[model samples]
Target: MARQPALSASLQPTLGAHRRLMAGLIPEAGFHAAPLDGVTFMRADANTTPAPVLQEPSIVLLGQGLKRSYLDGEVLAYAPGEILVVALPMQFDCDTVVQPGQPMLALSVRIDMAVVAELACQMDPLPPLPPGAPSAHARGLSVAPMDAALADALTRLLEVLGDAEASRVLGPQLLRELHYRVLQGPAGTGLRALAASQGRLGRVFRSIEQMRADPARELSVAALARDAGMSVSAFHEAFKRVTGHAPLQYLKLTRLHLARSWMLDHDLGAAEAAYRVGYGSASQFSREFKRLFGLPPSAARSQPVVPA
Candidate 1:
């Protein structure tokens, strides 16, 4: 019997363009685009070591090789014709499985909730959301096979980068189209869940933003519950249900991760970083940081920062 084909014709050209885009973006040793506020593309010759505290939500698609991301004790893997959706700030890891001759090349589009909100308003309302769909305690991570429409949109978006004039003129349009297409594809559910008003994940996402903005503020269960418009008990239950961690646990993790980023990117000492993240005791911060990351704060700071 003949082997089945791996990719549909509809997906081939777009994926081809993605492979080429990676080739250009990481022409030298792979580097990340500056963090959190923009797009970044990567191509790696070896598997990467994982990090303990990672934040930011982005879409991941591989053009040439394989990649893996971890969350909540689960390892999510993707490769050609696949996608990963990270919809919240969480600690995770990524590894490129492509070998020497076949480097892993992937594109990451950071999700701006603002952009997602804008696009969602423009989108035709989805059919009634699935029952138990807007779950708050679900993991904010998901993976899916890349379908043709999304692939084509991605291809067109990447092609825009080649023509500087066109990029300026058409970049936003292409980006919008890409987001729309993803929402229409299988990998879109997680995003849709986050975008839908009155949805559990949507509520959780709002609380997440609040917690991120003020990690040190004493957050009352009642206040956060009111923010989500759920009763105190409901809010607490949904928060853990959607994010795979208790609300306070999530806050602590987010703080620890942000502190790590600050230490690596700035001249801040461990104590300073801890204080910034709202920890009153430097020793307590060090203990938790070590437990989570397997390295003491100072030692982790001395290690080179990994380009995300």
Candidate 2:
């Protein structure tokens, strides 16, 4: 990947302030979800091993340090002054780089597709697609250099994050502005493709949303394809092409991820977690969980911690 331009001198102080504010929010090293909606802060103090991470729809902005993401045989690397946008929920192998004295600090702002689509309509329309432009299908994952305006908005958002009243009263408007900025950015292509749900990518995303919303519900490729208004073969191909996983496989991963989260965050037991995710058999859930995560369902609590 081409190296992004360094953060200009004029933007350094705001970037520095962003870093400092994030550090203060997370005094220790771990994944910390802020009181505000859809805001998650993370601090990684140690160099982390490449771990499978289920990334939701969000934009990951680094205050400091670097990260390499491995997905579908493609490796993407990003450092400070760059942002990673996930237009869909997918799994990736993430490796974080933290210097000995300086930990990696980052924050994720979750994306709400409905809100994005609404915001897109409120703004000036995007330019028409050029001749021979690629289809609406998008990778749903992209990295780009952060724009100065976006950086300034983030800094102001950070400034209000620590105060409950400010977060409640001012955060929404600021966050909305950030989303608008994103829609106008280089990384906005994937989002636009997803929002303009008149093409194959949008159809596939529809199925994805269904599976993610109710992972325990009975689902099949044929049914998903039908709902997407495509033949089984066409839907299967489109789903895998965009998400890097087959439809059924994607649903399975979603179930397993949810089950694991239930076990860890909500203190559910393996059997209960499996049942909640529609696993009729605990043994089967354990087997598949171990296959994907390299550990049994019961072992998830014991897995080494990493930034969320």
Instruction: Please name the candidate that would achieve the greatest lDDT relative to the true structure.
Output: 2
Checking candidate 2 for backbone clashes, the offending pairs are none
The candidate maximizing TM-score is: 2
Model 1 weakest lDDT span, ten residues long: 28-37
Cα lDDT tens digits for candidate 1, 1-308: 11112777777777777888767755655656622236676767766677553647878777787766666577776777887777776556555566667677777787766777777778776677567665322567777777877877778767766566877787777777777777776567668767765467778889988988887777777888997889988988888766667888888888888888888889789999899889999999999998877789989766544433
Off by over 4 Å in 1: 1-6, 34-37, 129-138, 220-222, 302-308
> Once superposed on the true structure, which residue ranges of model 2 sit more than 4 Å away at CA?
1-10, 135-137, 304-308
Q: What is the lDDT of residue 56 in candidate 1?
A: 73
**RMSD of candidates 1 onward, in order:** 3.8, 2.5
Give a tens-digit lDDT track for model 2, residues 79-110.
77888888888777788887787888998899
| TM-score of candidate 1 against the unseen true structure | 0.85
